[model samples]
Target: MHQAALLGGMIHDASHYGWKVAQPPHDWRKMAEAVQNHVKSLNWGHRVQLQDRKVKYFNFKASFVNPHMVCGVSKGGEETLLSADHIVIATGGRPRYPTHIEGALEYGITSDDIFWLKESPGKTLVVGASYVALECAGFLTGLGLDTTVMIRSVPLRAFDQQMASLVTEHMAVHGTRILRGCTPLRVERLSDGRLQVTWVDLASDKKDTGTFDTVLWAVGKP
Candidate 1:
């Protein structure tokens, strides 16, 4: 659910029919608004819990909500029988940050967090060589910020060479500095809370240097 467009969001599986149902294209902002509205539509509804503090390593207890013991299966050695018309496990995959990079956890911002940003960053450094990384870099640069993309190898390494080169060129032409073949070493916060990025340029054999108000780690996603 990404790559949103101005009129309608990017369409996924639009050509597929029968086995593959097509979902109508939607505006990203409008989709977000709709989700918020749907959530608000529920009044007192089901039990909801808000945890202010981060989870401090706890095991979850399994309590069946359905009464009828139709679906008989004790996978985790559950003492109680579980039954329901249908079970839906919507626990989706979450993006993870690379542990090798220093200060990434501290200064790093992900796609989940970037949407809530009230003030656009003065400068943004995106770390990845993938499509998402490139798209984010372009978006930030279009918003009138000094955006830089640092990739361990050539930008868009996974795509066709010629097409990737074209996109890389276009990004640079649009004012998004592309730093390919650079591996981020650390992300240090200055006194002003800005990120001072350090890296190594594999191609040039020189110390890579970068600074930005925000550091977006777009290094691959699930």
Candidate 2:
């Protein structure tokens, strides 16, 4: 994802008039394709494979049958039961959406979608204070996109506050607009293909609004 942003920055620089020698215009479609291909390569061995080793891997829907037994259902609807001395669950998580906010799920994307975007998300508004939120906003700003991060409270609540401040400060120094102590109230789509967001500053108890091409929700993973 960072590579994608770097590629975008290079493209922007080459196209800007300040360059002494003009370079060929960047092909967004080609860049997007390259990013997708690279992502696919990274997942080449995602599936577990078994060969000469005793370890076994299964690609199916798994459920706990007992404390030491599991049942798996394959794509063909075949069921397999296996027993072991120990069991481990390693399934990851998905991004959490602000369900209480109007138009959140229907209009917003998550970190999962950003890497897979075929085109740039222009003038992005990233909502959250998690590391994921800051990272996404950082990349977007690095790529020369108009990016903003709205933090409802302290940034990176789970991490060291001082280090988190430095991270956010660096991002701000690089051009990411930071809105602290603010929470989004709602999001609405404009006819011109932009997102209009309404939010409130908790400290001031005042409302504000902004428009962006994309609204990303990165509150956290639950």
Candidate 3:
């Protein structure tokens, strides 16, 4: 994920200064493949062990049956029960969308989808001020995309204010647009495949609108 950002920054700087460089246009498909391959390479040993039947991997949704037992349901609706000495809860989480925002779930994508996108998110509006939001916005901006970060209150509220300010300032110094004190109201899709977003400035109670190719909800994971 960070490598994408680094490559984007380098490309952005080169293009900004009009450097004569030979490089392919930012292709999300190619990037996604590269990322997946890199990850697979890093876990080759584990994959080999699983393939050799030395380890068992279950790709299913699991629930506890009792203190010493567990049940898992596979995608095909097959159930398997097993007893273990100890069970570990390692299931990961996903991004959360604002349920109150109209058309949010239907029209917007989350951070989870960004990394796997097959096409470039041309112009993006990332809602939230968390590290995930900032990091994504940073990379999108560096990739020469018109990237904006919308903050309802402050940036990186969970971290030190001074450091957070620095991070936002740095992003601003780059090409990332920052919208502070603003909260999204709704998202609507245009006929031409673009998204029209409506938001409000909390301080002034003023409403605004913007069109973007992507609306990413980076409001933190549940």
Candidate with the greatest lDDT versus the true structure: 3
Model 3 clash pairs are: none
Which lDDT tens digits does candidate 3 get at residues 1-222?
567768866765696787976665677778788877877787887778797986688777888899999998999999999889988876779999998999899999998888777788899999999999999998887777899999998888879999999999999999899999999999999999999999999999999999999999999877
TM-score of 1: 0.62
The runs of at least 3 residues in candidate 1 whose Cα sits more than 4 Å from the true structure, single-residue gaps closed, are 1-92
Per-candidate TM-scores read 0.62, 0.81, 0.87
lDDT of 2 at 163: 97
lDDT per residue for candidate 1 within 23-63, as digits (tens), equals 55334355456545655666223323222343222123345
Q: What is the lDDT ranking, best to worst? A: 3, 2, 1
Tens-digit lDDT track of model 2 for 53-93: 55566778889998999999999999999999998788899
| RMSD for each of the candidates | 12.4, 3.4, 2.8
| Best-matching candidate per TM-score | 3
Enumerate clash totals for all models, in the order shown. 0, 0, 0
